[model samples]
Target: MSLRAYLHAIARCPSLEQLWETHTQRMAEYGFDRLIYGFTRYRTSTSLGDPEDFVILTNHSREYTDEFLHGGLYFHAPMVHWALAHDGACSWAVLHDMTRERAMTPEEERVVEFNRRMGVHAGYTVSFKSISNRSKGAIALTAKPGMSQGQVDAVWAEHGSDIQLMNEIAHLKILTLPYSTPSRALTPRQREALEWVGDGKTMQDIAVLMGLTSATVEKHLRLARDALAVETTAQAVLKASFANQMFVMDV
Candidate 1:
C-alpha cells in the first residue's frame, strides 16, 4: 500500500482488530516480516499484575509473543528500555551503535539474544503517553538485519505524526473501556463545567459565561473533579482533554 493509503487506513480503524490489520498490511508493504503493536499502561493500578493493559494488535507469531511475555524478556529488553527513554524516531541499529561502547549487562545480553533468535535483527520503536504523561508506553516494529536505516527514516518521516495520533487514540480507547472496578461517569453539568475549564476559563469567568452563581460553578467544578477521580480541577481538565472529551479554545 502507498504511504498515504497506509496512514488513511490507520486513521480510519475504530477497533483493535482493524488497527492491527491495517498495521500488518502496511508492514508488508514496507517489507517487514514481523510487527508487534502494543499499548501498555506503565503506571496504572492493574499494570503490575496485567502487563498488557491493551494490545492494539500484532502479526508476530503468537508462540514468540507468549514466550516473550512468559520469560519476562520485555522488562529487561535494552531496546524497549531505550525506546522509553528517548523521544522522536529511533532505530535498533542506531541505538546499538550509539551504546556499543558501554558493555551490556548479563541480563541485557540475554534479552538481546532472545530478540536475535526471534529474527529481529533490526527494528524501530516509538514511545507515547496518555493524558497523564506519567502513564507512558512504546510501540515497536521489528525487521530483518538487511534493512537500511535510510528506509526506516523515510517511513518515519512520512508516517510519524499518524503513529503519534494512533497512539493517542489507543490510549483513549483503553481509558473508556470497561474496567473491573467501575468508575463514575461525568454528569452533563459537570462535563460542561470541565469543558469550560479545559477552554481556559477561570471559575469567576466560567460562572459569568454559564450564567450561574460562583458557588454553583464551584460545585460543578468539584463534581467534575470527583467524576474524573482527579485531585484538582487542573488534573480534571487534563484528563478530559486526553480522553478527547474537551478541547482547549484558542482564546
Candidate 2:
C-alpha cells in the first residue's frame, strides 16, 4: 500500500495487536524489520511509572526483549537517553561515535554489547512530541540484519519525511485507544460506570443511567478504584482517563 493509505490504516487500528502487526510490516518496507513503539503518562520526578503501564508495541525477538525489556536493561540504554533528551530522529551512528571517542561508560558498553549479541546494531530512534509535560513517547526502528548503519542512513535520507509523519500519526492514534496494565484495565461495566462519572455523573445518577441499583453502582466504582490503584471515584476518573480507558470513541 501507498504511504498515505498506510497512515490511514494506522489511524484506524482498533487494538494494539493489530497496530503492532501493521506498523512492523510498514517499517519493514522501509528497511527496518523491527519496531518498538512505547508511551507513558505516569512519569514523575523520580520514576518513569510502572512498566506495565507503558503502551509497548514491538516486533523484536523474544530473546532480545527477555534480556532488554524484561531484564530492565532498557533503563540503561544509551539511545533511550538520546531520545529523552532530543525531539527528532537520531542515527545509531552516534552510539558508535561515542564509543570511538571513549565516551560510553562501562554500563553503556554492556548495553551496546547486548545489542550486538541480539543483532540490534543499526536503527533510528524518534522521540515524539510530548503530549503533556510528564508524558513522552518514542519509537525505535531496527534495520534488518546485514543492513549496515550507512545503508540505513541512505534509506532515511530518501524517505525520512514519510517515516516521521507515519510515526507521529501512530503516536496520536494510540492515545485514542484504551490501554492499561492488565492489573489496571477496568471491566466493561466498571468502565461504563467510570465513563458516566467522568461525564460528571454521581453514583445515583450512574445507577439510574446504567439500570443498576445505587449500591451496585458504588460497588462498580469501588472496584474501578481498586483496579486503578486509586482512592476515590474522582481519582479513578483521572487515572482511568490517563490510561485512555474512559471517554474513548468506538471507532
Candidate 3:
C-alpha cells in the first residue's frame, strides 16, 4: 500500500488493536511478516525486571511471541539497549555499525539466535518518553531478508513521523484509561528544572539560569527524578516532555 493510504488506515483506527492491524498491513505491503510494537518502563528500576509497565502490539507468530516473553528476551535485546540511548528513529544498518565491535553478552547472543529462528533479519526501532516526566519505551518494526535498504528508508522517511506521533498518542491514551496508574505530581521547582532539561540545558547551565548553586540545582533535579520514578536526568526530561508535565515560562 502507498504511504498515504497506510496513514489513512491508521487515522481510521479507533482502538489499539485496529492500530496494530493497520501497522501490520502496512508492513506486509512492504514484504515483512513480523512486527512488534512495545513499550517499557526500565528507566524507573535499577534492574530490568518484568516491565512494571507495558503496551505491546504485535503481529509476529504466536510461537515466537510466546518464546520471547517467556524467555524475557527484552532484558538482553541489543536493539532495546541502543534505542534507549538515542533519540529518534534508527535503521538496522545503523544498529549493525554501532555494535560491530562491541562484544555481545551471552544473553544478547541468545536474543540473536531467537531472531534468526524467527526469520527477522533486519528491523528499525523508535523510542519515546512520557511528557509527564515519568516513563520511557520503544517500538520496533522487523523484516525478513531481501527487503532493500531503499525500500526501508523510503517507507521510514515517509511514515516515521506519523508512527512516532501515533505511539505517543497511544501511550497517553493508555495512561489516562480507567484503572491506569495515578499520574505523578511535581513541585514548582521540579517542574522548572524539567522544562530546562527538555530545552537541552545542562545542570551547570540550569544553575546559572536559575541563579542557584549547582548543588541546589542538582537537589531539585534529584527530587524530580525520584518523584517521576526515573533513573537519569535525561529520562526525567523525556518523561516530563511526554506527559506534558513541564510548564514553560516566558523569560
Candidate 4:
C-alpha cells in the first residue's frame, strides 16, 4: 500500500483485528517480520496497569507472547524499562552498548538472553508520546531472522522518519477505538443500571425510571459490579468511565 493509504486505513480501522493485520503487513514490507504495539492509560509507579486492560496488538506467535507477556518476563525487559523512562525511538544497539559498558543489570541480561533464544535478538523500540504521566504506549519492531542489527540499523537510517510517523499515527488511532477486557464488558441492562447509578440515582429511583422493580434494579447493579470485577458500585462506575463505556449517548 502507498504510505497515505496505509495511514488512512489505520486511522479508520473499526476493530483491533483490521488494525493489527494492516499494521503488521505494512511493517513486514519494511523487513520487520514481527511487530507488537502495546498501549495503556492506567500506568502507576509500580505497575503498567492490569494486563487485561492493555491494548496489545501483535503479530508474534502465541508461544513467544505467552512466554514474554503472560510469563511475566515483560516486567524485567530492559527495553520495556527504557520505554517507560523515556520517549521516541531507540535502536537495540543501545542494548549492546549497555552490555559492553557493563551497565545492564542481571535481570536485563536474562531478558536479553531469553529474547535471543526466541530469535527476538534485533530490531528497534519506539516509546510513543505520552500526553499525561499516567499514560504510556510503545511498539517493538523485530527484524526478520538472519537480519543483523547492523543491517536493520542501515534500513532505519534511510526510512526511520517514515517508520516513526506510521507508528505514531497508529498509536493515536488506536486510542480512539473502544477497548475492554472480555469479562469487563457489561451487558446492556448492567451498563444502563450503572450509568444511572453514576448519574446519582438510588436503586429504587432507577427502578422507577426504568419501569423495573427495585429488586430488578439491584440485580442489574450487582451484575454490573461483577462484570466489572469491582467490589463496589462506585468503583464499577469509575472503571466503566475509564473504559469509556459510561454516559455514552445511546443511538
Q: Candidate 1's residue-wise lDDT over 103-220, tens digit each?
A: 6778888877777787776767766644554466566777645776567667666865665565445434544433211244566677788888877788899899899999999998
lDDT of each: 0.63, 0.87, 0.66, 0.87
The C-alpha RMSD of each candidate to the native structure, in angstroms, is 8.4, 1.8, 11.1, 2.2
Between the candidate structures 3 and 4, which one is better when assessed by TM-score?
4
Tens-place lDDT per residue, model 3, 1-251, is 66567566666555556666666665665555576766554445465433433546677777887878656787678788776666567776654554586567778777877876777657677766645233466667776567754677777777667656655554455443211124456777888887888888988999999999889999999998887688999988766654446663332
Which residue pairs in candidate 4 have backbone atoms (N, alpha carbon, C) closer than 3 angstroms, thus clashing?
A: none
Q: Which parts of model 4 are misplaced by more than 4 Å? A: 198-205, 246-251
What are the TM-scores, per candidate, against the unseen true structure? Answer: 0.57, 0.92, 0.57, 0.90
| Model 4: how far residue 231 lies from native, Å | 3.9
24 Cα displacement, candidate 1 (Å): 1.3
Error of 3 at 73 (Å): 1.1
| Candidates ranked, most accurate by lDDT first | 4, 2, 3, 1
| Superior candidate under TM-score, 2 versus 3 | 2
Of candidate 2, the 10-residue stretch with the lowest lDDT total is: 242-251
Off by over 4 Å in 2: 249-251
Candidate 3 stretches with Cα past 4 Å from truth are 1-12, 41-43, 148-251
Angstrom error at residue 84, model 3: 1.8
Given candidate 1, what's the lDDT at residue 220?
89
